[model samples]
Target: MNIGIIGAGTLGMTLGYRLSQAGHRVTVLETGAQIGGLATWFDYGDFTWDKYYHVILRQDEQLLSLIDDLGISPRMQWKETKTGFLWRGKLVSMSNNWEFLRFPVLSFPDKARLALGILYIQRVNDAGPLERVTAAKWLTRVFGRRVFERIWEPLLLSKYGVLYDRVPAVIMWATIRRYYKTRSKGDGKETLGYLGGGLKTLFEALERGIIEAGGSVETGAAVTEILAGEAPGVAVRVGDEIRWFDRVISTAPSKVLDRLAPETKLGAVSASSAPNYLGVVCLALVLKRPLSPFYVTNLIERGMPFTGVIEVSALTGTDEMEGNHLVMLPRYDEPDSAWFERPESEVATEFLHALRRVIPDIESNVERFFVHRAKHVQALWIKEPPKEQGPRHTADGRIWSVNAEMAGRDTLNNNAIVQVANAAAQAIGAMGAPAKAPTAAASRGR
Candidate 1:
């Protein structure tokens, strides 16, 4: 089948790799200058690393298997890392069970409820029921109101604003299940994996594999229209000309598809059911000194401006950053938040000023700083089994949705996305897609 994929993010790239390996002619289209999507590489002067902070857990089997397939598994490395919790003008390490017990902020009962709830949620094999339940209700029931207010509530507020209560419990369930990897070894330490050269290594290898396997990848080639052609053939508009394909799978947001895809063919989903996205505004810094001892310092203090602090260098090692440190202060702003439009300088200053309260020496230790922003990064699910997910294929059965909540309820990660891509390929193949093109046709138009 001649397949056209929209949004060459990890989901798109992985889908392309899988489909090509399955003997389909694939062309992955990306609007950005490069692939990786959220996991794209950023230029940090002397070196480059992931555009946002990302990590690989020991349980990330899908991602690891893909790395092996790309012949780059040798570059993968694992290390022990610590997690930090900051509150009341102090930073505390919460990497181990003993530290969690000794933590002063929460009462013994609160801690017990929190720990016990996590243990229970981690073992739950089925989280489908959680889709209809609000995270607030589930958390309140399992961990008690006190724990919810003391710990999880602030995080929800910081990320989702007033819509926090509307978030599905499945998100929470997925998070706990994924997090169990850190302690599954029975050790107090949290071990994380990373490719030696960061995400760039993985993506580069993926692109190579896709091309070598008779697939093509395009960057800065945005698809503005996806109209259904003769049955089982789709027409994708890149510039002035329209290219036809046997099948088209889009990883773009539902709203985008609502505007671009031929709604009359498959019909458009209601706007109300599409999840609103939480865009992130981050102050990325190349620091002369590390910000905190932990890789991630969850901020719980009242009135804090940002969501959390991540010292990426802590996980990858400072030597990778040319002997400097890498820090990111990310704030997941609501859809209507002004941070998306505010001046980058102003946002950076505000984040740094608020951060200085905790790390008074922050500005002094910073060698370089960059403000980065990406809208539509994190999906905010307000309803269970979103209306858009009811049908993976359109009425014509030519267009398919790949990453659209069809990926199922899993914590947002490369590994989960890899598995989603694998599932998509298997489904497409099982449906008996047409024969692959002897050679990929060239994309026309500028």
Candidate 2:
């Protein structure tokens, strides 16, 4: 079989590698100059690291298994990390039970209610009922009005903006379950894993594996169109060339697909209504000194530009980064939000100004700063997300759409992306053989 995979990100590349290993001829097309998509990295003058923030939890079995299969498991490292919360103009620890007990954000009774709420959520094995309810309603009912207003609402607003009110409770339930399962049993601390050289190493290894398995990867190859082939396959237009393949797997966003392959009516994949997406504007900084002792600090206070401050150096270490602290300040908003059009320097200035509230002396420890923007970082899962409408096979069955957002059982992450890609490959394999050669009329139409 001859296969064409659009968007050579981790999902696309992984699919290409798997199909190639199955003895199929594979070719991957990538629009960007680099491959990893959201997992891609940038090269600073002194070093190179991920453009966006990504951490692996011990519970990420799908991602871990993929790493082991790529023969890069030895390069993985784990670190015990702490989390902090900024509330009422004060930073406080909340990583352990003792610190949580001492947290001044809520009263004693409120704290007890919060613990019970978490336990109740963890006890529910099925998420179906939770999906029918909104996070606001669920939290308010379980944690009471005070906890919901003080903690849950602010966090939801930071991530989902105005759409937070309609977000499904199952999303929050899945998040709590994921982190709860990743905690260390000995001390109840969270342990996060990272690749020694970052995700760049893992992506490069995947690319090598694809090539070794007889697949071709082309970057900066923007796909312009997808039309029905002369025979029973699909035809893709890359630049001025039109290539035919027995099957086409698209890992690009649904909007991108609707534009490229309108003939396929890919819009039906969303059942006419599309899922809302949140974009991220991240400011990565290399500091002369560390910002905080904790790896993650959730900002609960209002009037802050960024949601949270991630001091990745707490886990990645400064030695590999030439003794410079690496911090990421991520601002999530809609794609049409004015923040996306704001200049990078202006964004950096605004973020730095707000960051001072958490670190009073941060300005003095400056080094280098870079800003990165992703148009679609996360998909907002609605209470009734178009269930009957999602990534699926076209009427012809030769074209398929697969992406991280289509992950059924997990949230959008590298692990979920890999799982979706694997499932798509398996389905394609079961289809048997390549399409017959194009007919004379179809060839003339091209």
Candidate 3:
């Protein structure tokens, strides 16, 4: 079988590797200058690291397994990281029971309730009922109104904005469960893992494995159109040339597919509606000194610009970063938000001002700064069993759409993307011969 996979991100590349290993010929097309998609990296004069903030928890079995298979497990390192919360203009530690007990934001009774609520959520093996409820309703009911308003509400508002009320409870449940499962039994502290050289090492290994398996990986190959081929396969137009394959798997966003193949009945699978995505404007800084003792600091203050402060240097050693701190300030908002239209200089200045409120002396410690923006970093999941639920295969089972937005009941992360791609490969392999490629006459009939 000959397979053509569009968008050479983690999902696309992983799917390509899996199918090629199954004795199929594969060709991966990517629009970007490099692979890895959201997991891609940027070279800072001194060192290269992920463009966006990313961390691996001990509970990420699927991601860990993939790294092990790629022979990069030894290069991975684990660190006992701490978490903090900024409330009432104070940065307080919340990584352990002691710190949490002393947390001044919530009363003692409220803290107990918060702990019990997390325990209950962790024990919840089935999240079906939770899906029917919104995070606002479910959390307020479980942790009470005070705790919800003080702790969770601000965090949700920061990440989801106006869509905060529509976010399903399953999303929150999955988040708590993932972190809870990663805590060490002895100290009950969270431990995070990172690769020696970062995600670059892992992505390079996947690309090399695909080529070694007789598959071709092409970057900067923007796919303009996807049409029916002359035979029982799909044809993809990359640049000016059109190439046909026995199968096509698109890891691009659903909107891209809607534009390329409007005749196809995508139904609810298409993300052509408003409030479907959450964009991110991230500011990463290479600093001469560390910002905070914790790896993550959730801001509870209202009207703050960025969501949280992710000090990547806390989990990663400074030696690898060329003796500089790596900090990322990410703000999630609607794709059409006025923030996206702001110039980089304006965004940086505003972000720096807000950041100073958390780290009072951060201005002088900065060595270099860079900004990155993504229009569709996260998919808003207000609907139960997302419109594009289940395997990537469409109704006709010829073309497949696999991307982070399609991840149901799971957060959009590298591990979940790999899981989705693995499942897509199985479904595509089990299906019958590819459907007849759409010819001009056949396209008109639809």
Candidate 4:
């Protein structure tokens, strides 16, 4: 089969590599000059970093398998990672069992109840019919209003904006399970791994494998339209040229599908179900000092703009760049928010101000600062217009539609690469082709 994959991000690359390995000809069309989409890296003079910070957990089987398949396992190093919460001006270390008991933020009884609730959630395979339960209500029932307000409430608001109230409890359960199941020994510290250079290294290897396996990859190619082919194929118009394929798999956002195939019923599938995506303004600082020892610092202040701050060097255990520190200030807003329209300089200044408020020494230690903005970084899965309204995998004869929501619903983690492979493989089989089975040798990372 000749397959054309739209959007050469992690999803596109992985699916293309697998299909090519399965004796199918695959071609990937990428809108960006470089690959990896959200997980792509940007060169910072002496070093390269992801456009947005990304780390893999121990249970990220899909990602880990891909790394080994490409013979990059030696480059993958695992480290026990720590995460903390900044609640009501207090820095609370909440990464371990002992820390939960020792922390002064919650009363002893409140802490016990919270701990028990987390343990219960972990043991239960099912999310307990949480589809009807809102995150705030469920959390308050288990952890009390104080913990909800001081910890979870603010984080949800910062990530979802006004839609926070509508989030289902199942979403929180999925997040907690992913973290709890991946925890390294020694309390609740979770093990995370990073590629030798960056995520881009893994992406590059995958792209090369696809090309070597009788596949083609083209970047800066935009598919303007999706039209039905003369026979059993799909035609995509990239600039002035039109290309035909036995099947077409789109890893592009579902919203893009709605725009391209408006005449087909495929557009309406996810039109009303477009979950809001929060924009992230990442600030890379060549700092004189580190912010904190913890990798992630979750802040909970109502008026504060930034939701989470990640110190890259502290997390990686390597200070490759002199005065090296990369801080990510993620702020949630609608796709069309005023922040997106503002100049990058203004965004940088705002981030610096917010960052300095939390880390006082940051002002004097900073030597260089660069900012990158990701519009619609993640799908607002937990919130409005509710989970039932989310995008469903629909086919209008030839065109296939998929995005974060579809991936999250079908797979364990809505990871970019995994989603692409799962969605594309499903699309291909649905198009009258023999079901492509996962090669055991390939799955074993041989």
The CA lDDT at 400 in model 3 is: 76
How big is the positional error of residue 316 in model 1, measured in Å on the Cα after superposition? 0.9
Best by TM-score: 2
List CA RMSD, all candidates: 2.6, 2.4, 3.5, 5.7
| lDDT tens per residue, model 1, 223-316 | 8988674564677898777777778888877677777874643325535565667788888999998787899888777687788889999898
| Candidate 2 lDDT by residue in tens digits, 179-257 | 7876765666788999988999898988898888777889999989988744486888988887777788888878888
Determine which window of 10 residues in candidate 2 has minimal summed lDDT: 437-446
lDDT of 3 at 90: 82
Kindly list the per-residue Cα lDDT of model 4 for residues 1-446, writing each as its tens digit: 77788887777788788788777888899888988887888877667777777777778887788788888899887777777777666567777777777877678877777778878888867664776799889888877888787677887787667778987887777777777776755676667777777788888898889989888899999988877634455678888787777667777777787777666655565666665565666666666667777788877777776667777776676554444676666776677777777887788788888666666766788777777777756665653343443224334335565455555422233254474475566556555542342232322211
Q: What is the lDDT of candidate 3?
A: 0.83
**Model 4: ten consecutive residues of lowest lDDT:** 437-446
| Tens digits of per-residue lDDT for model 3, 7-119 | 88888988888888778778999999999898898997799999887888777788899899999999999998999888877888888778778889989999999989988
Give stretches of model 2 more than 4 Å off.
388-391, 437-446
The lDDT ranking, best first, is 3, 2, 1, 4
| Selected candidate, larger TM-score, 2 vs 3 | 2
User: Pairs clashing in candidate 4?
Assistant: none
> Worst ten-residue run, lDDT, model 3?
437-446
Pairs that collide, model 2: none
True lDDT of residue 239, candidate 4 = 84
